[model samples]
Target: MRRYLLQDTAQGIFFVTISNLTKEDSGKYWCAVSTKLSIGNLFDEVSLTVVDDKTLATMFISAC
Candidate 1:
């Protein structure tokens, strides 16, 4: 499967999809929007964690 996909859903709106995630995929990511001025750039940072399906299931079951 493709590792990454980027799409422009609407004006000034975007989406990113990371497929076939693994533990190694966990890390910091950045999203940025560019403008004419270098200092006008916008940025957002995200921390992502990928867990196995079994682990997620266990978490859900334990929470119930």
Candidate 2:
């Protein structure tokens, strides 16, 4: 149940929020920006990782 939050950059740079992340949620996220000066666009991509809750807890307790 992954979700995306696209903010309105109508006023400039802003923040984006994601929710309900899962293992498959891992991927490249791009944020494109366009302005009057630039005929093209600017993109910022990030790699995300989402691990299973059960697996995470198991690893956490074992490491401790």
Candidate 3:
């Protein structure tokens, strides 16, 4: 598996894309955005989850 860095946007949003996702890729990821504020740096946290192929299939089935 390879870790890919998402491009930073001017809108203060960051994302990461994984290619050729696998079963082992299923996990939680932490994403944060930082910017300088009046007092100090401000941080916003976003959580990411990569689903294994099997789990994704299950999700699709359940959704239907």
Which numbered prediction scores highest in TM-score against the true structure?
Answer: 1
List candidate 2 segments past 4 Å from native.
Answer: 8-11, 53-64
What TM-score would you give candidate 1 relative to the actual structure?
0.68
Candidate 2 residue-wise lDDT, 1-64, digit = tens: 4365545544564655666566776666655666566456665665666776222210101110
How do these models rank on lDDT, best leading?
Answer: 1, 2, 3
> What lDDT is reached at residue 14 by model 1?
67
- Which numbered prediction scores highest in lDDT against the true structure? 1
lDDT of each: 0.58, 0.50, 0.43
TM-score of each: 0.68, 0.57, 0.47
In model 3, where do residues sit more than 4 Å from their true spots? 1-3, 38-64
* Model 1 pairs whose backbones collide: none
Report how far off residue 20 is in candidate 1 (Å): 1.1
Q: Candidate 3 lDDT (Cα, whole model)?
A: 0.43
What is the Å distance of residue 46 in model 3 from its true position? Answer: 6.0
In order of TM-score, best first, we have 1, 2, 3
Q: Residue 23 lDDT in model 1?
A: 83
Give the per-residue lDDT digits (tens) of candidate 3, residues 1-64.
Answer: 4445455554555445556556776655444434465755543333335555423211101110
lDDT of 2: 0.50
